[model samples]
Target: MAGREGPRPGGRSARVQASVHGAVQALMTRMERAEITIPMIAVEAGVTPSTIYRRWGDIQELLADVAVERLKPDMQPVDTGNGGKDLLAWAEQYAEEMSSKPGREMIRDVLAAQDGGGAYQCCNFTKQQIDVIAARAAGRGEAFPEADAVMDRVVSPIMYRILFGEAPDTAHVARLVSGAMGLVSKAPASV
Candidate 1:
């Protein structure tokens, strides 16, 4: 009967919920940088290992969820009434975000895990992000094939730079964006 709180199960409260969520994010950040076994994370977060497991189900699930939470892709599609400008904006923003230290590390972690089909599993969240772009492009009468081609080009190089630590300067981003635009322009109207 001692230490029992009214109404809340497991002695958890709304404020405690926020803290646990924050702890999860912090743990994921650490994990992305290096090995982060659950026990270490639990100790760092001041929570029991059971609490982490109960909240996230498993390590992979926790990582995937955290990665999904971090990737806030701009949902706006290239439709500034001038397709080229919109596409360029997308490229610049995407490049800037992906090149950041934490962003690159998170992506690298997810990609490395992809070997055991974990990549595809974790990618469901990312695909939703792509769908947003697709929707936005479609809304502006942009062809799906063109949009897809453009995005593929724009994202691929950024990923490459992130993984390899290669330079992705403004010139590089512009070039890639331009290349993608060229492809999109040449793509067949349908399919």
Candidate 2:
């Protein structure tokens, strides 16, 4: 799909996308997101409004494009040396971030995207992080829930809350994590 990344990854298309995405990010820091318009973004990025419209279709899609980029996992979940702790820490942080104004906006945008590619990408990003945590836990001889189970049991509720104007508190996140952890199957004891 023709996202902020564009159809091609090199040369003018990439450059234009980067410039546009950069422009949107820069704008977000200074002003309320709702007040910003495509014209303003185009001016900041040095592209015409039509360029953005052609690429993203509308403002919501453009925002979703930018939000997906922002939502990408930058680093692996902090290794706490214990599987449950690692997941607890990660889930707490995830809940907080996705509950914030910007985070909430990003989630909404991803859900609003026409092609639903942004939603898929965001889900994949979360699952990848969970998988990493689970893999790391396994390496340490710790039991951890499958990433899918965590996604369904832990992350899904969190997202549902955020989407419906209910930002999850730490207690909520802790409970979700604890519940998800229950899904892990202990490895067979070594003979």
Candidate 3:
């Protein structure tokens, strides 16, 4: 086959990444993280085990990559002309997703892999999401909320509850969003 001759350059590499990512996602839907092996992923992705090992080294790294890619917030920023409202909307969406079954599974898997040192970087996904929101607020001439503040006030609460066996409901998320907005409003201009 085309891929068997050797690495087929950019197009084939992209295809392999997509296939492996898709396989990981599909397996996550049907199997626990501990049960997912590199061999199984390679089989599902229609690639050799060596290919997976060569690219990712192990299942933890692969899982981290998959989680980061799958968990990225949509790039389009919410532009409601009010930075607080836009931030609230974004936080609410994030809270809702993190509370869902699949979302919880993804978080669990990624966190479990963090001890290996590769998965902690997946948290950068949240940083990127915040950057997108901050840029949108700036574009609207509104005060941009500090990313660290948003993380502590908004994301941290939801994640804490998730890890503790309680998923925040919409009302709770709304409250968290409001609290985050309050912090942003009171934050010094230098923030």
Candidate 4:
């Protein structure tokens, strides 16, 4: 059943993607990310190995897709009429998620794949969240934080600590977010 040309919307391709995605999540619960193989996923997904290879190239790519689908922050940016407070809330949530067990595992897997010379290509999910917050702030006539500054001041520190030994607590995250807000507030608005 491999004679189809390009992807057909709402067809077998979508079904396969869903199945594979589900299979990855399911397998992750039982095994380490590095231990999960394409063949194992293929069996769990009920698709052929060739199908997975053709669609995703490798386990790293498939895992990246799965991470994007499942590991993204669940809440939208909060708008409390105060840009700094809104930003702090969002950053705290982001940090908390990244410090969770599943989040740490996902990051370890993705980073391992990348370090192992595999093409694990998920964009910075935190950056996307920051952009949404910035847009909302701008819409409300509040000073929008620069995405880079947020990443550097808030996201980077949380991730660094989490990935290393000590995951920061909520109090620490609040401080980090507050520090980031200070940096953002002092900068001139982007032209």
Provide backbone clash counts, one per model: 1, 0, 0, 0
Tens digits of per-residue lDDT, candidate 2, 1-191, equal 45455567699888888999999999989998889999999999999999888878888988998999999989989998988899999999999999998898898888887889899999999999999898888887787888889999889999999888688899988999999887766663243
Clashing pairs in 2: none
TM-score of 3: 0.77
- If the candidates were sorted by their TM-score against the true structure, best first, what order would they fall in? 2, 4, 3, 1
Worst 10 residues of 3 by lDDT: 1-10
TM-score of each: 0.62, 0.91, 0.77, 0.78
Query: What is the number of residue pairs that collide in model 4?
Result: 0
Give per-residue CA lDDT, model 1, range 122-183, as digits (tens).
34444455566566666766654344565477666676776787758888888886777665
Model 2 worst lDDT window (10 residues): 182-191
RMSD value for candidate 2: 2.3
Tell me the tens digit of each residue's lDDT in model 4 across 1-191: 12325446788889998999999999988997778999999999999999998876677767766766676556678877777788888777777777888887777656645333221233455677788888877876667658898888888888889988788888998888788777655554565
The parts of candidate 4 lying over 4 Å away from their true place are 1-10, 30-35, 73-75, 114-124, 184-191
lDDT of 4 at 6: 47
Model 4 poorest ten-residue lDDT run: 114-123
Candidate 1 steric clashes: 1
In candidate 4, which residue pairs get closer than 3 Å at backbone N, Cα or C atoms, i.e. clash? none
Candidate 1 Cα errors over 4 Å, as ranges: 1-20, 26-37, 43-47, 54-61, 74-79, 114-118, 121-145, 184-191
What is the Å distance of residue 177 in model 3 from its true position?
2.0
lDDT of 1: 0.60
